[model samples]
Each structure stands twice: as C-alpha cells, then as structure tokens.
Target: MKKIISWAIIIYVLYCIGMAWYLFSFADSSIPAEWKGTTADPATFLTPREQVLSEQYSQWKNFLFFVSVPYDWLAYLAVLWLGVAKALQTWSEKATKSFVVQAAFYVFWLSIIMSVLTLPFDFISYRISRAYGVSTQSVFSWMRDETTDFLVNTVMLFLLVVVLYGLIRRFEKRWWLYAWMVSVPFTIFFMFIQPVVIDPLYNNFYPLKDKVLEAKILALAEKADIPSDHVFEVNMSEKTNALNAYVTGIGSHARIVLWDTTLQRLQEKEVLFIMAHEMGHYVMKHVYWGVASYIVLTFAGLFVAGRVMNWLIRRWGEYFHLHKISALASLPLFLLVISVLNFSVSPVVNMVSRYEEHAADEYAIKLTKDADAAISSFQKLTKEGLNQVNPPIIVKIFRYTHPSILERIVFLERIKRGD
Candidate 1:
C-alpha cells in the first residue's frame, strides 16, 4: 500500500511539472487588440532621458530573472545546503542530543551562510537600481536594511525548522499533515504582525499627513465600505524612486499604505485612483483568498515532499549522510524537492494572481468612476517603474503578479467606452 501511494505521488509530481512547462511555453501573450484600442502605447510614452534609463533598468531586471533559479535554487540552497548540512551535523554532534535544539542550531548557521551567498546578487541589483536613478539610499543604509531582513528571516527560519522537525519526529508518515495545519495560523500571524512589526524595521510609516488628501481618501474609503481611520505613507523615497500603494494585514491591522515616492510622483487624483485600486483588493477579500490558496499549495507540496523524501532517503541516505527524513541533515534534500515543486507551480499561481489584479482594476474603475485617473496612474507607474509593457507570454505567466500596465490601461479604456 505504501509503495503504491509513493508511486502515485511521483506520477502526480511529474504531471504537475509537465503542466507547468506547457503553461509557460504556450500561454498567449496578446490580448484582443480591441481592448488596447486607442490607448497611448506604453513602449514610446517616456521622455528621451527617461527612455534610456528605462531600457537599462529593464535589461537589468531581465538578467536577474534568468539567474534567479540558478542563484537561489542551485547555488544558494541545493549545493550550499549539501556541505553545510554535514558541517552542521559535526558541530551539533557534541553540543546537544535534543532534536529541536540541534535543528535550531543547524538552521541558524544555514541562514547566515544563505544570506552571505546571496548578498552579491542583491548588491548588484541595488547598484543597478541606483545607476538608473531608481534608488535613493546610501550604501550604508542599504546594508542596514539588508542586515535587518537577514535577522528577521533567520528568526523565522529557526522557529519553522524546530516545529517542522518536531512534527516529522512525532508523526513519521503524517508530519506533512500536521505541518500544513500549523501553517494556517502561522501564516496569518505573520500577515497580522507585518504592518505593525516587520515594516517599521526598514521604513517609517506615518499617517498620510495631508489633511485635504486624507479627507479625500477617507471619503473614497467610505464609498468602498472599508475602514477609514488612517491611511499610511511609507518613507520609500528614502530608498527608491518607484511609486506604490498597497493594503496589507487583516481586520484591525488592515489599512492603506502609500509610498512617499508615490505621493511625490503622482497627482492627487492619481493617488486616489491607486487607493481605490487597493480598496478593491480589500473589498474583494484578496488577502483571505490568497491565504486560502497558500494553504492548498502548501498542503499539496508538503504531502508530495513527504512521500518522496522517504523513497529518496532509502536510495541516497548514506551518500548525503542522511539516515532518515526526520534527521536535521535531511533538510537540504527536502528543501530541494519542495523548491522544484514550487517553481513548477509558479505559472499557475501567478495566473490566479493576475486575474485578481485585473478584477481589482475593474472594481477600481467602477467605484471611482474616473477612468482617466486610472489610466494615468497605470501609465505613470509603467514609465516610472520601467515595466515591460509587452513582455513575452512565458515571462507574464511565470513572473507577473499584476496584469501588464498596457493590459490594465487597455481594459480601463474599454470600460470607458462601455465595452
């Protein structure tokens, strides 16, 4: 029975991988030209100086996309973890017999090494952003932010590993089930705390502080039926020239946050349009839906990983110095499997996200009744952010969380025409 179940899982994994490839290779990039009717082309919308910078930024981003898998999956996680696991095992051998303590120790060392290994890529990306006039932070400030991120992630990684390994030891066959169950609350807790706790570590967030604009936003929030006590402005201009506004957290924690750069770059109407879009996300319950989707994906990935890890350990246990799936040393192998599975599903996951974003765009237009503001906002953001208006289908399917700016503007124009 166990053999049959394992084989069935292997087949399902192969099927999912194949489906992912098909989605990436064959997804359509072009929407109906009717939707794009009479809208200004984003490709040629920028000033000459801005165009040059935009091209450079796009090229840098494209380069990063190509190397992401190799750097993150191959070098940082797989190959690094192989040797790191053995070294950690040696270090932890005499230090403790408690599994949770030993797992935490291994996680701490792995987190540090992973951060170091990935720092060069991160540095280069920051340099490119600065060269293109997108980033405003000094090197010292950037390093400080990076250090904070590393520490936060390290602590989270330690807790997760301890709980994960504990589950593995307690229930050999059903560890994945227990882990998935815990992740429901675990994920929500992070979401709930992120606005109040994690965000302040990097940037200061203050009430919008513009009385007239705040009143306008509050009015719009009332129209949308969302909470309106406060809208936040993040100190993003201190770090980047990009424009953004988002709604995050849940219940009392949920509120609007706009980047200071957004305030500087966009007009009042445009900012209101952006806020309306965020309100769309809130009213539509994208946050809750996103969490539910995560739970489903996490459950599926964990189940598959659990099944395959058992078989993998049997075959290559001694070679990797892993005696069992529950062993701390086996973490790298399990991570490698889960990473591959997650990458495979990225296109499908992103497809759903794009749909939600499109829905938000439609909702914003409906609620605001200001098609012009919505169109202007998308164009300004596309130009300022160096967005590729017409990227290849594969890139859109695999990478885009929002619909392309061109697609969005086109859609709003259609709505304007009563299409």
Candidate 2:
C-alpha cells in the first residue's frame, strides 16, 4: 500500500511540473514579435493616440508597485501550509477526527488572511478611480461595497469548496458529473441574486430617463425579438473611468444596464451603437456558450486536482502535516490548473467574444446608419478608459477580449466605403 501510494505521489508531482512547464513555454513562444520594441524606440509605429494610451499604462504600472502588500499576504498561505503539514505529521494515526478538524481550521484561517490582503488592492483601485474623477464613491461607501462583496464571495467559496471536496472523495472517477450538477444550482443561484442582490449594492439604477431613447431601445428589442422591458441606466460613473454596457438577467428582471458615463460621454447615436453591440451578444448566445465552456473547464480542473491530491495524500500526506484533506494546500495547485487552462485556450475565448462584439457593431450601424458615430465612440471610450489603441497581435491573442480600436475603426471604414 505504501509503495503504491508513493508511486502515485511521484507521478502526480511530475505531471504538475510538466503541466506548468508547458504553460510557461507556450506563453513565451506565443508573445507577438511586434511588442518587442524598447520603450525608447522613437521610430515606433504607434499613432499619437496609441502613444497616449501607452503612457497611461506606464503610470498604472508604477501605481502597481505600491500594491505588493496584497501579494505578500497571499504568500502567507504557503507559510500556513507548511505549518499545517508540521502539525499533521505530529498527530497520532488514531486521531483522524482531530486531523480533519485541524485541516479545516487551517483552510478557514488562510482564507481570512487572504481576504485581508485583498482589501488593500480593492481600496487602492477605488481610490485611483475616484482620483481620476471617474468614481463618486466615498471611502465609507467603498467600504460598504467591499464588505458586501466579501460576504457574497465568502459564501460562494465555502459552498463550492465543501461540495467539491465531497465530490472528490466520494466519486473520484465521476467527479466531473458531480461538479457539473453542482454548477447547475450555482448558476441558478447567481442568476437569481446578481441583479437583485449584488448589483444594487454598488450602483444606483433607474428606468432609462429619455423616453425617446427608451422607445428606440425597446423598438430595437422588438425588431430583434428579444423580450425585455424598459432599458435601465446604472450610475457606473460613480465607480470607475471605464466605459461599459451589458445586457444581464433573464425574464421580467432582464434589462440592459448602460453606464451613466457611457451615456454622458457618448453621443446619442454612439450610445445606441454600444447598445446594439451588447444586444448582439444576446442575439448570438455568446453568454450561454461562455458559461458552458466554463463548466467543462472547471470539470477538467477538478479531475486533475483529484488525481494530484490523491497521489499527494497517499505518499507525502504524513510528511507534509496533512491528515484528512487540506483544501488550503490544494488551492494553489487548483489555481495553477485553471490559469493554464485559461491561458492556453484564451485565443478561442477571445475569438468568440470578439465575434459577438463585431456582430453588435454591425447591428449598431444597421440601426443608426451612423458608422462615423460608431468610430468616434470607439475612439472616445478607448481614450477615456486608457485602453491600448494598437496592442500587438500576441497581446490580443492572450489578453484582449474585444478587438482593438484600430481594427474596429478599419472595419467600420470599410462598411462606409462600400456605401
């Protein structure tokens, strides 16, 4: 039994190492050649607009240096892992209950510690938004929002981990099915609570103010055959400089949340264009596809984690101070798995999202007949949000969800020229 367990542990460790190496190698190899130019390159092909966005990225990078406090806090979880391992090694074989209790306690303790670490970045991000005149939330308001987020996330995390651990132990071979079943309820719970419970905690929402705009939007919905009531505006300007719009919720509760900043900053035609874009996501069923993809990826991650954990527990369980099951120790491994999956498959995800966005852009043009407005809207939003105007192809593949501003502008230009 001991030999079998030892070999399982060895094989699992090697698998993890190999997986990590493959991910890193792919990322390195995939970096686009265009982004390799030095910061000092004067002859760079960056347009004046691109130069300005790049400068903002530089400033944000500097601000990020002060944000290392959170990373340090996350590191403490590893330290806790070591401590738990020591404790488990010293425990008697007969004390299984005590071992499990200790392991659970450590998981909870690390979770609390990581949450505290995350607070600084959360506060800093909000502060920067406020400083930039993008957000209107006061420190007190920010704290309230953070507390609510923490509570919601904590509940979700606990439920997910508890169910996941049980699935791994009881139905190791059928863990994927168990996980998919769990996600059904989880998805329903999120859908029910997000609009009602979660979103209202951060921003104010009111029925769309302009009757003409509301009618136009509703008319467009009718044309698209999407059953939705009045369009809604979210006071998103109170939170960040970022400009975004989305269609969320289902049935009667379903409504579009247009950011106040987007409305104020963009022309009426431009705003409609943005709405058309969001509607395209719904029309194309991109959201459903995304959710399905996540379900499959999550199951894959759990299967890998189970195999790895079983091997680790059998061989080094005693040596590492892990008695029953240590969710905390397994977390880093789980994250690594998810990260690799996301990075490797990012191009496919981006391509799908970009396709939906393009469809929306086309829809907007069709409705408004203002391709010029669409182009200007893209430029203004990108500038205001400090988005890269001309990121390299490599960056687009790995990082960007939507196509670059230049690409969109060119596409619209072609549409205009054809007319």
Candidate 3:
C-alpha cells in the first residue's frame, strides 16, 4: 500500500508539472494588429478611474484566490492531524442512534468549523469588493446569505457523506463506481430544483417585466431553439454592481436570468448580445456537457481517492486515530485527497469551460450578426466587472474559468475579419 501511494503521488506530481510547463511555454502575448492604432492595451479602453479600480479589484481577488489554496490544504490537514475529525466522530457516536444520523451530525459539525475558519477570508473578500464599488451588499446582508448558504451546503454534504460511507462499508472494493453512479442522478436533481427551490432564497426572481426587451430576447432564444417563454430577472443590484446574465436550471426549470444591474447599466444592443450568448449555452447543451464532464472527472477522482485513502489508512491510520477508511473519522483524509485531485485537474476543467465560453461567443456573433455589439459588450463587461484583461499566465490557466477579456476581444476581432 505504501508503494502504491508513493507511485500515485509521483505520477500526480509529474502530471501537474507537465501542465505547468505547457501553460508557461505557450503563454500568449499577441494582440490583433487593428488594436495597435486603437487602444492596444485592454485596460486603456477603460476610463482612467476604471483602470485603477480594475487593477485593484483584480489584484485583491487574485491574492485571495492563491492564498486560499494553501490555506484550504492546511485547514483540512489540521482537522485530521489535530484529531478534530476523530473528536467529532467520537461525539457523534455518543450523541446519535442511527448511523446515518451520526454521519449527519459529524458533517454538520465539521462543516460549521470549516466555515468559521474560512470566514476571515470571505469577510476580507467582501470588504475588498465593497471598497472597490463592486459589492453593494451590507455585511449583515452578506452574513445572512452566508448563513443560508451554510445550511444548504450542510444538508447536501450530510446526505453525500452518509451515502458515500454506506457505499464504502458495503461495496468495499467498488464503492467508487457506486458513488459515481449515484452522483449522476443526485446532480441532475439538484440542477432541476435549484432555480425553483434554492435561488429565490438568496434573491428575488421574476419574469422580465420589459415587454420590448423580452420580445427581443425571446426572438434570439427562438433562433437558438431554446425556450422562449420567459426571461427571468434577478435583483442582483442590491448585492452587486457587477453586470452579467446566464442560463440556469434544466428542463422545465431552465430559464434565462439577467442581473438587474446588467439591464440598468448596459445598452439594449449589449444586452441582446449577452442574451444571445446565454442562449448559445442552452442550444449547445453546455450544462449537460458540463455535467457529463464533471461526472467523468468525479469517477476518476473518487477512484484515486479510494486508492490513496486505503494506503494512507494502512500507513498512518493508527497515528491519526483513524480505524478504517470507511470510518466517519476518516472524513478529513477523504476531503484532503479529493481536494488535491480537484486542484490537479482544475486546469483541464477550466480549459473546457473556456472553450464553451468561446463557442458561445461565436454562436452569439453568428446569430446576431452584431460583431460590433459583441465586441463592445465584452469591453463593457471588462470595465463593469473590473476584470483583468491579460492576467498573469499562471493565474489565468489555474483560476480563470473563462478566457481573459483580452483573449475574448482578440478572438472576436479575428472572427469579425474572417481570419
């Protein structure tokens, strides 16, 4: 078991190094020739005030993001090494009757502690956003949202842990496969219910009230063969000054959602471009594809986690006061493996996401024949969201789920030129 884990760790480390090599070796620096006479630098297109704000916002988020990676690793490690998980398991065993109920209690306790540990980072992020004029949410309102989020996450985590541990106990060898099978339907159920059952808890949503705008958006949706019945507007301005729109949910619950801030801030043409892009998401079945990709990754991740977990239990189980891989006390170790696996595969996952975004951009341009609108909309989003146009290559590859604004703009110009 020690030998197997050693090999796995070596291979995983090598894969990450290879990805880093590829990322750095091919770091992009080119911009379109047309950009030379105009604003060559994406930030220059913003107002002087906006440029300063964009840099500050981008730097703060990037620093927080990178810092949190190591912080999360240490937090999970602390819970395991400090016997926090063991303590929770002991308490749950004494406090509960049903094994499943005990699992729930353990999950709740661990989740609450982890949330508290991460609150300082979250609070700092909120304050930074507020300072930069992005977040409009008050600290009290943010805390309320965080509390609601915590409860929802705890319930979901409790259910997942109970099911996973049950599988580990019963199947022993093939539990990873069973867990992956269960996740498919579980994920679908959440996607179907989120818009109706969960989202409204955080913010208000209603059918878009603008008849003229609704008519235009519905026309675009029809062209993409997406549902044209209703476009939902979320009251996001109360929480954020950032402008955006997206497609969410699945099947009957599937709907287009516009941040109210987007409508208030962007032009009608820009809004149409944004709507078209989101409709492209539905038409292209990006959500289903995303889910499929996630399931595949989760299958591999769980398999690796199971393998590494067994080795770890054999190697240091007694030292950590962990009895078995299936024991509730092993939850922290399970999380640590999963986190490492997730971080290792993030660049690949993010590449797929960026591809989807680029495809959607193309679809929007092709459908609207409004390349000008699309380009301007990208610029508007860059300024409004305070996005970095050309963030550091390492940061872009690891952290960005969508292509940088500069990349999108250059791509758009190429498409416009038929290049």
Candidate 4:
C-alpha cells in the first residue's frame, strides 16, 4: 500500500509537470497571427478601458504585488500541495467517524490561510474592477462578498468530504458507483437551489421591464422551440460590468438568465444573437450531457484516489502534520486525483464545450444575418472584460472554456464568405 501511494504521488507530480510543459509549448507555437497585433508604442497596446480600470483601484494596497508572476505561481502551487497533502492524510485513517467534523476543521483552517495569502491579489483585482467603473461595490462590499464566499465554500466542502468518505468506507471496491449515486442527487439539488436560493444572496435580481424587448426575446425562444416559462432576465449590472448569458437547469427546471449589463450595452440584434447562442446550449442539450460527463469523471477520480490513498496517508501523513484517515486530511489526495483527471481529459472537455459554442454561434448567425453586429458585440465583450484577443493554444486548451475573440471573428467571417 505504501509503495502504491508513493508511485501514485510520483506519477501524479510527473503528470502535472508534463501538462504544464505541454501547455507552455502549445502557447509558444499555436498562438494565432491575427490575435497578435503590433503597437507603435507599448502604451498603444493599453486600451483606454484598461487604463481607466487600473487608475481607479490603484489606491488599494497589495503586499504581494511586488512579487514576480513566477513567484506567485510557485506560491499557489505550494499552497495547493500543502492543502491536498493535509486533507488526504486525515481521510486515510480508520479512527475518524465523522468526515464532516474533520472537513470543517480542514476547510476553516485552510481557507483562512489561503485567504490571507491571496488577500493582496484579491484586493488588487477588486480595486482594478472598481477603478474601471466595472464594479459598483465599495471595500465593505468586497469584504462581504469574501465572507459569503467563504461560508458557502465551507458548507460545500463539508458536504463533499462527508459524502466522499462515506463512499470510500462502504464501497471501497465500487467507489465509482457510490460516487455516481451521490453525485446525481447533489447535482440535482444544486441546480434547483442555485438560482432562487444561492444567487439571490449575492446579487439583486428584478424581472426585466422592457415589454418590447421581453416580447422579442420570448419570440426568439418560441422560434427555437424552447419554452417561454424558462426565459428570464437578471439585473447583474449591480454586481459587475461584465455581460453574460447562460442556460441553467434541465427539462422542466431549465431556464435562461441574461445579465442586465448585456442588455444595457448591446443593441437589440446583438442581444438576440447572445440569446440565440445560450438557447443553442439548451436546444442541443449540452447541460444534461455536461452533468453526465462530470458524474463519469467524478467516479473515475474516486476510483483512482481510492487505489493510492492508504499509501499516501502512511508516507506523507506525518510530514503534513496530520493524523488518521479523515476527509480533511485527504483533501490533497482528492485534489491530486482531480488534477490528474483534468490534465488528462481537459482537452476533450474543451473540444466538447468549444463545439457547443461554435454550434451556438452558428445558430445565432442563422437567426440574425447581422454579421457586423456579432463582430461588434464580440469586440465590445472582449474589450470590456479585458480579455486577450488571441491567447496561446496551450492556454486555450488548458484554461479557456470558450473560444477566443479572434477565433469567433474568424468563424463569423467564414460564415459570411459561405466557406
């Protein structure tokens, strides 16, 4: 068991290194030419929007701001390793009865430590957003957001740890089956409660008012054959300047949410394109498939984790200052398992999501022949969000959930050319 765990750890670490290398290599080679633009001066590259945002939050103090990016990255990696190691050690012991008790302690302690470590960057990000007129919240508001996030995360962590430990204890041989059984209920519960219960605590949501716009949106849904009852608008502008639209829930519970920021800035045609794109997700049944994929991946992860957890506990348990096999101590093991799964399958997942996005974009273009409107909307979105127009292929494969702006523009241009 000890040998198995050591091998697993070594293999996992090697896999992570390999993934990082692959990502960096791809970024260097596959970055699109159109996305790379030269500036007459370095300052010419800084968009007015970026400048305003930077100036606004410049007052916020960041202790770690002085640290180089590479150092920050190393610090993050170290924290993740420590947290995971501590968690796995606690979970591998036979003495622990209640994973919840263990996980709570682990989450509480780790969150505080991580929060302190991340404070400088967090404050800088908040201040930057505020400076750009993208964020409405004051410092108090930022603190409140953090507090709420901490509480929610703690609860979720406790639940997940308890459930995972229970599965490993009872169904060690069939951990994957147990995990799948647990996930179905949890996913359904999350879907049902998230919009009405969880979201309301974070941001205000008022029913959309424009009767003309409402009718137009509803008509698009009807044309797409999506139920009218599922169409809704949210006043997300109060929270952030970012624009977004998403399709949530499944079947009867499925609904659409469009941010007020999207509506406020975009023309009617642009809004329609966005709506059509989201509706495409629902129409294509991507949400159901995505959840199903997660369940499969979760099961695979638990099976892999179960195979090597005992050995890890025996070897690294003392080093991480942990005793027993509880959920709390086993977090690092869990994270390592998850990271392996992600590293191995991320490109496949990205391919799936990108395909859906492209399909949605196609649907949007079909609904509105306003290629110019689509192009302008994408430009506005990328600019407002301070997104890179073109990112390295490795970054896209590893990090991006959506295609880059340049890719979207190229696709749209291709559609225009009937190629």
State each model's CA lDDT, in order. 0.77, 0.62, 0.83, 0.66
Displacement of residue 325 (Cα, Å) in model 4 is 4.2
Task: Give the poorly placed runs of model 3, Cα more than 4 Å off.
Answer: 1-34, 37-40
Candidate 1 on 83-195: residue-level lDDT in tens? 56777866876699877678778888877776777788899888888887778889999999999988898888788888898999899889999999999899989888888
**Candidate 1 CA-lDDT value:** 0.77
> Looking at candidate 4, what is the lDDT of residue 209?
70
Model 1 clash pairs? none
TM, every model: 0.88, 0.74, 0.90, 0.76
Which ten contiguous residues of candidate 3 have the minimum total lDDT? 22-31
Clashes of 3: 0
The C-alpha stretches of model 1 lying farther than 4 A from their native spots are: 1-38, 76-82
What is the descending lDDT order? 3, 1, 4, 2
- Give the distance in Å from residue 1's predicted Cα in candidate 4 to where it truly belongs: 22
Q: In model 2, what are the clashing residue pairs, if there are any?
A: 85-320, 85-321, 277-360
Give the per-residue lDDT digits (tens) of candidate 3, residues 1-419. 44644564566566555544443454443345667534336645788788767766876787677666656766776677678899999899999788988998899999989998888999999999999888999989999999999999899888889899999999999999999999989988999999999999999999887889888888877777876764799999999988888888888988889999889888889899999888888889898898778888888999999999999888888656786888898988898889889989999999989999999888888888887788788887887788877777778878988888878777777776789
Q: What is the TM-score of candidate 3? A: 0.90
What lDDT, from 0 to 1, does candidate 2 have? 0.62
Worst 10 residues of 4 by lDDT: 59-68
Give per-residue CA lDDT, model 4, range 1-419, as digits (tens).
35644664576566556545443343332234443442211123456656334322321211122232323333434544455545443553444555556556666666666567667777877776776666777788779889998888778877777677677667756765777788887887787667777877777765567779989988988888988778777877767777788887765767888888899998988888888889888888888888888877777766666665666667665654445444355564455555556667888888888888888888888877778788778866755565555555555665567887768877886667788
